[model samples]
Target: MKKTIVTVLYLASLIASAQPTGLPAAVHPAEQLAALDGGFWLAREQHQLRQLDGQGQEIGRLAIKSTQLDARGHIAAVVDYGSQQVQLLDARPGQLQRLATLPATHFSVEALCLYRDPQALLHAFLIGEEGQGEQWLLSASPARKVRNLSLPPGVVHCQVDDASRQLLLVEEDFGVWAYPADAERPFQRQAILLKQPYGKLKGGASQVVALPGGVAVLDQAGMALHLVRYVGQSWQYLRSVPQAQERDGIASLAQGILAQGVLAQGVLVRDAHTAQWQLSRWPTKAPTKPDTLPIVLPLAQTDPVAKLGDAADDPAIWINPSNRADSRVLGTNKKQGLLVYDLQGKEQQLLAVGRLNNVDIRQQVKLGTQTLDLAVATHRDDLALVVFNIDSDGVVSELGRIPTGQQDIYGVCLYQPKGGGLEAFVNDKDGRFLHYRLTMQDGKLQGQLLREFRTGSQPEGCVAHDAEGVLFFGEEDKGVWTTSARADAPSQARLILPVGRRLQADVEGMALYHGPRHTYLLVSSQGNDSYVVLDAQAPYRYRGAFRVGINLDRGIDAASETDGLDVTSANLGTGWQEGMLVVQDGHKRLPDGPQNFKYVPWSGIAEALKLD
Candidate 1:
């Protein structure tokens, strides 16, 4: 026994020495940046590719509009923005090929990544935005004639999960779409990771990312974040994250954005005042420093969420109107119900949501109680209206359920009647809008349907106000409609995105916020994952559609589908509130399985509205 004990001690020492020490030594210093690879390819706005090392140091420079890197620190393909062409570089010794013209009009290179076949033929998949759908361009040569990869329309971003040997395509509202990369027809639906549609948000066009054990996702509803793992034969929810309340301040880095089982990066802010670009870098267990510092990039346009695909879904803000404060936000998930976020968009709590759909918070409420804000939500399976007391420990309860045949009800609203009573309104899948009288006794909702109106078919949006004595809504196949407090009044619904433009008018969600000059009507469309802002007073003309992505054919061939839409106040940020909108994404499950959650910010929306 003593001999065995001595032998164990000797073996234990060998194991101890084999393990790496948790020390604070610099993995790659500024002077030794070339030692590291596999990081984000950093570049300036002019499309100048600046090879940044792990320590955020420039190791080399390549004047190209866009670039994709290989395992080693070498440029695979470089696009010449001026001439609209591509230049291939030799892998062994980095040298660019003279000239190569790609058979794509206005072909700008983006979403570049490397994928290899089982035979070890390393190929690069590059996606570009041409017309309504994205162009899938694949290349095996560093700069050979770019091959057109025939894929389904609506593919916005893609990734080849080397571990799963499959391609994952994110279609807006359809769910996490997967396809076997090795198959001849590599673009057929394989498996749906998870899908739950909340009113306005589409189940397709969401984002996906790989985790240690399984995959995680930001649901298309823009209300929740989820983590799912394949156990025996089914996908089960390992964890769920809640929704975030829209705020005005910037979130600090100390309080990281939390989702699934890991840390999430927050908004990449470019300090216009100081011309410095600040990126939120979450701490990882691996010994590493930030890839980029808080310095302005070479080009002016710097939207970090641009290339992130669908990971950006939930929107949150710090309460103090600054990036260095503690804060909370409200968000949602497809599997879980509602989620409240802290200052950093971290999951505060995941509420037990039952068929919960779209959620909107009333800001600038001068109510006496500290809980001034009110959250309104639509339901899926039932006509239930989920209402929450907007306080620190706010509790969301069923305010009242509409009794119109438990079909598909999408929109909900809280309005006080001029006569005295408070009213609740809900939209239905079949063409009708039901109005209810909300009777909240001791913080519990007890209600009944007061009246029902024919608002064309598939009423998608609902907005009402007692003070103004006006209610507004819109239909999917129809156009915008409005009514008054007078019961005998005839409802007047107008065709906003009229006839020919009706192709672009699959209205999904709507919100009315008090703009500086006028009340802006924010409308949603699942057809293109876009939104339109209309003038409140007169001439409700077009406000350019907000553009987002749907990577439908990274590896999977998918039927293009878009759904779910919500518009937050531009004042969601400080001062005027940077007008931001969160759209739900559906087809985002990738091979090897990963989290696919997406939310986009329309800082440009605020600018166009002159709010910025």
Candidate 2:
């Protein structure tokens, strides 16, 4: 009889019918729960957000004053919290909808999350609250734009991990902070703190999860559970788990902790042979190991091309002052325009020349009677600057365009002024800046604007030293400024790297290097993918910060959000004969396709910062 109707349909699918008995009990006290995919979401405390099922049965409610979850928990945003609005929904299984709402802001949102980046894009951070009380972090994007981000005045709650694409936060009496939820850099009011390990610690952290190399939290009036981890760029303290009550949400399951308490909820399970002997006793202290940073291995990579999202961003080495292994790097492909590599990273040329964004190189220019070696670039389609000459067998030709009547052209640099000619600084998208200069009349090369400055907000990675007439730029939200490359001088500028120290707020791509006695600079600490270096002279001091990691015998993959970089003391022969840096990886992760450029080996950053 067909196995007796398959044993009565496998006992009615193990007695399915989750529990939905017409639900009603949470009009105001859940505080947070989550679960999803056919059941549970809660959030209560009277602001409402329900959505039950699987026998608890409300099935979708949402008056919401708060709720979050997206880092693939499948959507859910909510939040009205005094009308700083936002909706988002779509939590799956039978599919709920609402997808996008956002709009309200003059501050008042009170904590939110969502993140998606790795080129997936979806953003949305929102913590708001300022009417003079301060507390920011806004960030939107789904094209609604937004930005803000200042935070650190008592945060209260925020969480995003998506497996260490991190965003954490917490703060009532000051503790946890983290951030870098990969919105591709520029939100850094300095956070990575963590603190509050004991010193009269009693309550406050109410939930935080993240795990797999640490995070856990959960305190809520001392029903404890800690575990921090990160060490090496800070975060430490690893042990706590005492909890016999009060949890109000914790998660992290595959077979172990679920928490959720209004009086003790369950799921602790994890004994399968002593859970790796209880994580090998968990407790170690002499851990002060910090200066290590040296991975570098990408000997040859550059023919993959299929652009779309972040089509690589900036790189410019060009050495070959007559074959240093025939060197030549260029790179910019900001959605099609310049590429050229070789010194093994192959690809020799692309040049569609339309988008182009930030690129530089000067090397021996003279022009009218000929000497050439230019390169320029910053053409965001037509705000112009382009140029390019090279040749002598390394190729690259165009040699023209110079517009810059500025509309959005951004970040470029090429100086050459130690006493004779050539300039070009260019910046836009609102941090103003112009400079120009370059000459060669009857033979072509033009540019003349001379001077105009600004830098109040959105600047872009610039560079120039030309034997110290100085220039360095990058104000994208504030940090790294230095000025006066002589255009009548006096534009004054200053503020070295100051958006929460060691550069963060999009203060990207600067590069100087020089060295023989330390010239350094480097910057591009694009909000923590790391590079900072300094001491290019003066009080520029702070000399340390690396990150480019991961090699696996040349399989490579660990440079994140970096945007434009190029260094070279010029040796360029074997594994970068004491020189080469290149970068622009913005998440290239090995054979993982699209976006490229990453070739470190400045002697592995001079033996990982023992510098010289």
Candidate 3:
């Protein structure tokens, strides 16, 4: 029995050596291969990656299932199937250090490729199978951040050709699909090369070899390979290459040589230079126009301030009752002080009030026997409420300073009750709030602390609806909370909008737009760069949210990262006949200048939102 077994093994070895293209006698065979600069990587049996030199000499080995090289061949990414992670390795000579490991979710990684964008940033594209014919494309950075791209189901294989800047994927029943490998833009479907029922291909595509202008597909169609080109936005069959034996894997090598890996026979080399390979540029798709929403025209913008960063934070508007055209907007420049702008957005007055954060206006406050238009703001430098009395000529003069008695003062709003007298609600960075009542004593305004409350977290952007006796404030990381405006009212606060429901964290500002019978509460969802409006009445149901998109008519940019906003129901003149909304744009990217306030017409908002 031992002699018979030895004779069988000897015959098997002899038959393997007599094959047309035979590999070197080794214990394990290569399942996958990737050619690099001076060497190549081989995925051998037992989940090992063997690095070989040009002379076919083994240099180093690692436990990886799949391997790919970056466009510059400076980095190599290997897939660890058992660990469910992709390992990035430095591909320099004698320095095969693992740089980073990115976690993957799919159960099995079928294929792996490396993509380098025009900026020379390296990315790893991994095709993972999650069972039940489900597949996912994961684009991962070296920092382990992954973005999953949705793909058609039943993807068999994927490859990237840096020379042609194309990403090719083979589906089970659907043929080959092409995508642009540019990392700067989002992945878009380029075209479908071939389908099962229409072409001469009988079975699913098992492998794909990327050529100069197109790709060569190897399927089970009479055991032959076919070349297809993308021309005129469609796939056109070029030619076919007859194969003597079935090739399991094919790779484009240097010097115009094609390496084909056969099952029993080793690697076969063929001169592809003689083939009439069509070399054509991939058709560039026309840029699709961005979906334009209703334009919110910016009537004017505040003059760019000198402060580079953290200059503009909040804004408040006070309309001149006698002259609607003389309305004034007061904006806080955190680094400078307060700036007063007219209806035309021209800076008419500048007060060096020292580091004020937020400002609000209260009209017709009867102080003793005198009526006053007051603008109160949070004085960050002194932790006090800085009051300003707006004269009939639209000029503002300092009234008095009242210490908030808090370490940090953030948002401030004035409430003038129907019963007369004015109250200021001031909040600190730690969510603590103090309500102060303003009165005249000896012909001078004085602020007396009436009540104090806490919102359990950081809060800012408070507004008062005096008619309804309701005060709304945003709890920075939480949501909008409403409470009583009267000092004698209950301390219990009700949440109008909770965190994470249409509203994101750090809810920055709150404004009220009072219509004829309906009122709406607009909150700045700073985290998502959106504005959410809700019914101001009880059960404050959510209306819709709209982003201040680009306005090409006025050549003004969109509003984002808004801190404070103010909307008025009273009509101003000219373009603002239906009133106006003023918002502090944190990022003033248009024309590339400093941050400033953007004036949006209230009519546009009402018509766009269909708000009565």
Candidate 4:
């Protein structure tokens, strides 16, 4: 790679010409400025929050102690360390409306920044003297504490990179430490760049501007900019861009604008002593690898499973024939049992039938003369099929257990014939499957061995498409394969999609959503935390992929590391007119509880992916 240094040349003459460009007057000390949509928001040493236009003109002003703008610029968080209060404001051009005020940390704050979580909630990170750091959920009514963290001493500046999921803290005399932005994840930190004799930095790090997969740090003492590349799990100091002249006090930094001056891209700097600005210009460029686009926000998330780590594994949606609105979701607590949740994500029932891995449901099953809804799960403890009967009123009760001779049972799916025969296919960890015919003989449920199937590798998640008479299996660590579901069909399975760029490995879950013009297959690409969509029928043309983003409006975290998912093309009365897609949430946040399942409306996925 070519070693390129982004050199920012500062001219003192620009200082005298600053006022004409609408730059703030050089009277009060320069403070850190928050980047807004059309301009910037800042709290000067004069004890007031000021907004500046593109030309640096004063567009709005508020009497607040300190202000920090979220990356989206939709909300402004003002912190008054002295009074120990935090204020939230709607950050619009010329309309900085005060929304709410709440008491923040009792410790006197030194540095603070607003971070938006995967669930779209805004949190304020309060950094006090020494390494005292606390995270508070400001978006919650009355505000609540999230977690307490630690940082290297002397962090006068901090920023959250929502894109990279990293919280950057500049240790004035040392370097920059990138902490996991998701507070719920493990507490880990990486030294991104170091200062002085031990490293390449010319001066101590003062401020940082987050780039797509990197950051540009401002070395205050040396009057230079350090660009750092964020590699997987770590960051490296790439190079530096030195300034030509000194303009004093402390400087503020912001990004995301069309660069008109110094470095690379839109890195803007304002001198605290002069209130004058120095701009760094970076060539506007397109992103390299495509990002997880067209995000679909989750509507609701179920209560965390009883088991703590890696418990919630799969989910199956049960549509209510009598009342679609009251449809329930069936999820597996791999460490516990079966969990039944309503559309609102409230746990409606729990059946401690043993460790259940994967789950599936079939509505209107013929149980003698009564048509009932049934849920079938792979009981890992017994390596058998545990059944539950759901009633018209959405009530649930244990039916019976069907034992499979397989050594291990990891995934299960039901194949219900329209003519009234209910069968199930259970997969084991060694890639062996057993198909069983579920029957009622002498008024007792029994299982009769039908046929068998074999795969090349381990399989867990499986979905049966009744319309196509085909069963799709996720060969974990590989990709997907499908075979005929007919009782007498060949046991051979053909690989439809392999592990590749579009379909990431450890393919966790497979789901089928039958639409009016198109039937699609949704696969959980666990390696990348995204879902890949493909044609459900033959060729299985790849449509597109998307990530479940946090719904800031609802405070529901995105789903990740999914194990099993199920979709239904029925009118879910609760406005999921097209249908509903439910998946296991491997990583749960918004206070970091146990794993749960997230409810996503299929219509949102259809619209985002432009599905027919």
| Order of models, best lDDT first | 4, 3, 2, 1
Model 1 — TM-score against the truth? 0.46
* TM-scores of the candidates in the order shown: 0.46, 0.33, 0.56, 0.79
Ranking by TM-score: 4, 3, 1, 2
- What tens-digit string does per-residue lDDT give for candidate 1 at 66-164? 332222134344445565444444322223223334445444543333444433334455545331212222332222322344444444434454444
**Per-model CA lDDT versus the true structure:** 0.42, 0.62, 0.66, 0.72
Q: Pick the candidate with the highest TM-score.
A: 4
Off by over 4 Å in 1: 1-335, 363-372, 393-405, 416-421, 465-467, 485-488, 502-505, 549-562, 568-576, 587-602, 608-612
lDDT of 2 by residue, 1-612 (tens): 000000000001011111111123442244444554323343333466655544335656655565444324456565655655777776664455566676666666556666544433355677753311121212223334423456666565676655446677666454566766653343453343344464324645544555544555655453665666665456666456564444344432221111121111122212222221011112222212223334344455555545856888888877777678887888888788988988777787887877888889887777667887888988887998988888767788887998878888888888888776678888898779888887778877788897798877788888888888888887867788788688877998888768775566677888898978778888777766778788877798877777775444455455767878888887777777778777787755333457787788777777767777
- Cα miss at 291, model 4 (Å)? 3.3
Clashes of each: 70, 6, 0, 10
Q: Which ten residues in a row have the lowest lDDT in candidate 4?
A: 1-10
lDDT of 4 by residue, 26-92 (tens): 3234354455555354434446766665545667777765533333456766565456666678778
Residue 510, model 3, lDDT = 83
